[model samples]
Target: MQSTATSIKAYLEEIPEERKIAFTKLRETILENIPKGFVEQMSYGMIGYVVPHSIYPDGYHCEPKLPLPFMGIASQKNFIALYHMGIYANPELLNWFVTEYPKHSTQKLDMGKSCIRFKKMNQIPFELIAALVQKMSVQEWIICYESAFKK
Candidate 1:
């Protein structure tokens, strides 16, 4: 998720009316399942979930000025996107998701390396998304990220 919304509220407000409901529902699902110590804020011009600098002093490796980004949700021109860094870093998790997404719905899964793009509201798998989010903790994500830094 990347864009110029100064705040999450601003980010939400900028979403087109057609996307707000889906984004809002996904936002609620994310908020409900996010691990402790992760905070929601505007990042890269979108609504991002991050480990704050206060929790992890080093911040983002590529941009230490920013927090450690875990996930993000953005409404693109063609679809709504969910960026899951945890899945991107963990191949097993990605494989599991790719295998299981179809079980949640019949719609085709459209995804990028770390982005799950929903072309329709019904294409969003709320329970599956919630389950995926719940699988990672802040500590787990930090450890995974740190290990990546070593290589």
Candidate 2:
């Protein structure tokens, strides 16, 4: 569910009580491992990590006013979702994540083009998520974003 909360703190507060711990840990994992240069903010009604306008003045191609989004996390209706643009734009990263998922969790990966759904909070692989977050830097993301989405 898209949250109407304007800040990350408020967003977290709005999530179901049972999910708060896991979701907060997931958020912490991303914050700790994400390479330098990405800024944390609320974007698309979720907790978003983005290359700010200071770094990428061109902004998101789809919406130039918005920063270039790198990753996002949200507590959805039935699951918590982690959205990584790197995995969607970089096949190598996607493959790596796919290959390593089984080693981390027994749960079959429930994923979309860029969104990884954690239906079981206990199964959310914080370590795997940490590794994934560190796989790309802001500069690398800008390059990948331009190549994959910019016309």
Candidate 3:
């Protein structure tokens, strides 16, 4: 669900108590492993990791005033979601994550394009997410995003 909270801290406080721990850990995992040059902020009503305008001043094509969004994490109505633009743009990365998912969690991969939904919070695979987060650097993401989405 989209949140009205303007900051990550406020967003965290708004989510259900049952999700606070896992969601916090998930956010921490991303913060600790996400490559440098990415900035954290509230984006599209979620906690987003983005390539700032200082680096890519063109901003997102869909929303030129905002930063280039690379990834986001949110506590949805029924699931927690991780949205990674790199995997959606790169077929190889998507294949790699799909293949490695079974090794990390027993739950069937519940995914849609870029959004990986974790219905069973206990089964969230932080390690695999860490590895995935590191797979794409800021420059690489810019290139990939331009090649695939920017006209």
Candidate 4:
């Protein structure tokens, strides 16, 4: 479910108390591991990491006023969702994740293109997710994003 929260603080306050711990931890992980030039805010009703307009002047294609989305964390009806634009846009990145995920996590990987679903906090592969987030800088991600459209 997309939250109606206007800010990250509001978003957290809206999440169920029990889910807060896991979500907060994931948020911290993303912040600690996210590449330079990314900003965190409430976007798409989740905690979003984005390439700011200063970094990517055109902003997001779908919504030019907004920053280019890189990753997001959302609380859904049944699970927490992690969205990775890099993984969805780059086959090599996706393949790397699919292969490396098992090495770090014995839990089943539940994903759909860019979205990883976790029914429980323990199911999340924190280190693997961190590596994935750290893999691309904003400039590299922009190139990848544009290249995908050219294909």
Q: List per-prediction Cα lDDT, in the order shown.
A: 0.89, 0.96, 0.96, 0.89
Better of 2 and 4 by TM-score: 2
In the range 81-147, model 4's lDDT, one tens digit per residue, is 9999999999999999999988988788899999999888776888887888899999999999888
RMSD of model 2 against the true structure: 0.5
TM-score of every model versus the real structure: 0.95, 0.99, 0.99, 0.95
Error at 57, model 2, angstroms: 0.2
For this target, which candidate reaches the highest lDDT against the unseen true structure? 3
Cα lDDT tens digits for candidate 3, 1-151: 7999998889999989899899999999999999999999999999999999999999999999999999999999999999999989999999999999999999999999999999987999999999999999999999999999998
Lowest summed lDDT over 10 consecutive residues: which window, candidate 2?
A: 1-10
In model 3, pairs of residues that clash are: none
Stretches of candidate 4 above 4 Å error? Answer: none
CA RMSD per model (angstroms): 1.3, 0.5, 0.5, 1.3
Candidate 4 residue 4 C-alpha distance from true site, Å: 0.6
Off by more than 4 A, model 3: none
